[model samples]
Target chain A: MIDFENVKLKIGDTEITIGAVLESNGSTSNLKTGAWRSMRPVTDLEKCISCGICWSLCPEGCIIKRKDGKFEADLDYCKGCGICANECPVKAITMVMEEK
Target chain B: MAIAGLPEEEYLSCGHRACAGCGAATAIRLITKAAGKNSILVESTGCIEVISTPYPETAWKLPWIHGAFENPSSIASGISAALKAKGIEDEINVVAFGGDGSTYDIGLGHISGAFERGDNFTYICYDNEAYMNTGIQRSGATPYGASTTTSPAGRESIGKVEWKKDIIHILAAHKSPYLASASIGYPTDAFKKIRKAIETKGPTFVNLFATCPTGWRSDPAKSIELAKLAVETGVVPLYEIINGKHVVGMPRDISKLKPVEEYLKVQGRYRHLFRPEKKEMEINFIQERVKENLALLLEYAETGH
Candidate 1:
């Protein structure tokens, strides 16, 4: 089973961790730069309005909301192009542009 | 052979580290072609100044001077005055170059002063519409609903909450002999405007909408294409106010014009405006503003004032 808590995504060559739960299933590779790193979307829950704008606007459609109504960005399919942060209406998301 | 009907001599070098697909760089290239060899360039503090000249080396091929962030117009005015006093007005043409940050926000005072004095110079604002040198900070020219470092995505704020200042109209207020707006998207038109401004006797102003790849989060190859879309979408109209007369250029078929979505989608700055939870009211507000502004400009042009 995948741990939605420790779930992380790869955007470009950077690794992004989403929540507290960490999970490992398979290896991921960076297609653009050929560098290896995990990427995840970090959210300031205090600022999030549960608007789900990030989920709808995610090009990869990797973001999912929990049963408790809190939205979570799935890092496994997240591309880390920063469109989520750009799309977040309530300024709940920020794309941490990290260098590998 | 002349690249753009000018000599092979270059005023801007290629080694300067501008953001990939920078409109300001392209503006420099075009302005150099129009100004030719006998010109003085005044650069304001912004992306061009910070990236091109890192304390020592500069990429300028002509006589270029760096001024404070808000002083390109004032400094160029001073140069023109001194040149006139020295009886060297016949020897050199004064040209001032700055980004929108310096031109619209910090440099408005200097621009007003020069225009009021009717200084013998041509001022060009390579408008990228933000404080790009400081990590994509918002300025006066940043359109409504566009995100920036200072105007981050957040609740109750749709990015920059203001419309772009009407620079040509403001210059018109100064009663400048020649004033116009151009875009790198329209090279021939831009070239013509630059040449016309330089040839004018008194102070002239040209505000060109240059694209920024890094700040806008767009593809480097699509810089010019995006600039063109800005014009077509009526986001940035191409027109001139010559001797207080408004002359609109290239009347686009608004019927064939693509939705503002197409133009906004390509850049990361407007990414927030394209969401579902994002109220259509916000997007509609922006759309209405754009239409209103364009209509006002068109009306002014139609009225011949």
Candidate 2:
């Protein structure tokens, strides 16, 4: 029998399980997909309404409601698809080019 | 307060490899929310499967399993049977999901068998209209006149000549208790249908019209708008078939459908139809077909068939 606890292997700072089985759920959050963004979304809190359109429509589910009741995307995981800006009713979000 | 009445709990976490603004990802988020915590998801080999699970990492918060490209429904059936054996079949939800490549073509037989047996599960097909994961090859779900790598519209040929397969009608033929067609554009409606499908006993099916901006060559931000246009143009009607009775959902009036051109012009797949000279004949054909399909659905709804 294979010992579950002793078979850990490390790959580039991240530990990989032996059989491609992840013991923890939703571990993909560790991957920062924001690196794929060529554009970044900027939300205008002054004009923003907490309609949750951005939160509901976000493909990554990266948008979170801040303490002020306005929702903004977590840039660490946001890929900058611009759907939030496009679907924003009040035009509260705008897509800007990512800086090098 | 509840984020448009949807549960605040998220089952599909952030940071996956799906393209930015993927409609399937949006649909999946809503789906997992509806399925809640006590659920098992069976995934067919497709884009979501590849993107969500990248060896020792998974985006799914629920118990999930991936079978081959053509056997998600079969796996779901087995899972349902196991649940039944365990005597907790009614306590958990079993949801099988796949892309158009698997649902419309490769795994059609397996799905048919599962539906025939009245397995207690829900099968959701996120229809992006092509084999997007494998480089945009045409599938049975690919609508007519849409160009793909395999069905290119060139000097001599117009895109895919065949009409999209009426998958809902086929599934309804099995006398399944519930069958519905939804679109990511209408998240609330889609969520309701998903919850209802999961709550229903026996086999239920939901055809979710998801958009593929990468495959369709459409602007990424316009995915939801394109899906909305598809429904408005009568190209993808949102409706439910309950016990063989048609319950038409949106765009009930025949006069309300926007011209098919409005829907086609935004996507690069149909660019050939307009550029290098407009193909009026092809455009008219698509328009007529859309009307006829919606009219048929209206008749079914009226006749209680």
Candidate 3:
């Protein structure tokens, strides 16, 4: 049997192990197992003018710069502020809101 | 003793001040109702504090404390910390409320710090766009091209040159226990979100869009109407950023939503945007931005979490 202590969050229908929980309430006097929201980036390459506006404005610095200078967001760390989409002059970078 | 819903008792008495059809007042009333009588209100120096309390008196029926313009979250954090230290954590729910100016502008760092520290409190930002308490000045949360006391419509410029700050996502990055966005137009959703914030263990931040008739130069009665328009027009999509995921609760048909012009024309702040003589490119630019936002939100909903 899988150890309950070792068990982590299972995501999607496949239940892919994304990341282990570093700290669970751990008998803390007041803390509890918290819930989190996942944010994904959706870029329409056709509409994208390669303006790099999204790259410059990302607060989390999750947007990745390629060898070709084409901008793409790092899905793992992107918090989905929608600033990239909001600041995009050509309206290319958009936030894909993931439901709980 | 219903934990799932707001209390029926009115904690914010309707006596002292607040302008005619103040959205901040509605936010105060709604928030107090959700938090119940066993709650302490931490207010910043803005429209809510200025209008509700005139030094000698207050309109609040529950326990309330006023803080500086940029330190309501910190003040609330202190209150929560004190409660924990005194071992009376369950006796009262601590809530810090502020206007867009205090929240998205001067108080962002404080709000972020409180969240990062995992302060046990419910933080609500009643966003009415501009700094209404300070003569309708432009705030960081103000939308692009909207006229304010500071960003006036002139031959040189349209209005505010910046876009609204998304504090919910910022708080989400802190990995706070709970985070969400709500609006006065969606009372049931707003009530649910705030109730969740109160019941949660760690820090909870909710960004509420409050319609300001005085600030935005709109009809007082159109507060709720404009509020609904904000959600529909994608100017402010209704969503929750819990933990780290972004979720838009209301994903109705975009075709049913009124045009950007319909929402813009009613508010005098955006009158310059609708000018017939303006270059077609600038107007088209605004239109494209709105459409792109709507499309992005809808697409996000499709790829289910």
- Across B1-305, the per-residue lDDT of candidate 2 in tens digits comes to 37966888998878888999899999899899989999999999999999999877889899998889999999999999999999999999999999999999999999999999999999999999999988999999999999999999998888999999999999998999999999999899999999999999999999999999999999999999999999999999999998778999987987978999999999999999999999999999999989999999999999989
> For model 3 chain B, where is the 10-residue window of minimal lDDT?
B1-10
Candidate 1 chain B: 10-residue stretch with minimal lDDT = B1-10
Judged by DockQ cut-offs, is candidate 2 incorrect, acceptable, medium or high?
medium
lDDT of 1 by residue, B1-305 (tens): 43223334445543455654466766777787789889988889988877556433556667777888999889888999999999998679899989999999898998899889888999999999889888899988888888999998776667888778888788888888899999987766887899999999889999988888889988754677788888887788798888888788854454555567678888888878766365577767766776777777778878887
- Which candidate number has the best lDDT? 2
Residue pairs in clash, model 3? A36-B243, A36-B244, A37-B242, A37-B243, A37-B244, A37-B245, A38-B244, A38-B245
TM-score of each: 0.73, 0.96, 0.71
For residue B43, give model 2's deviation from the true position in Å.
0.3
Model 3 Cα lDDT, one tens digit per residue, B175-250? 9877777787666578789989898888898888888888888865456667777887767778776665567786
State residue A70's C-alpha deviation in candidate 1, in Å. Answer: 58
Ranked by DockQ, the better of candidates 2 and 3 is 2
Which parts of model 2 have CA positions greater than 4 angstroms off? A1-19
For candidate 1, give the lDDT of residue A61: 32
Candidate 3 error regions (>4 Å)? A1-100, B1-6, B276-280, B298-305
DockQ, per model, reads 0.01, 0.80, 0.01
- Superior candidate under lDDT, 1 versus 3: 1
Candidate topping DockQ: 2
The TM-score, computed over Cα atoms with residue i paired to residue i, of candidate 2 is: 0.96
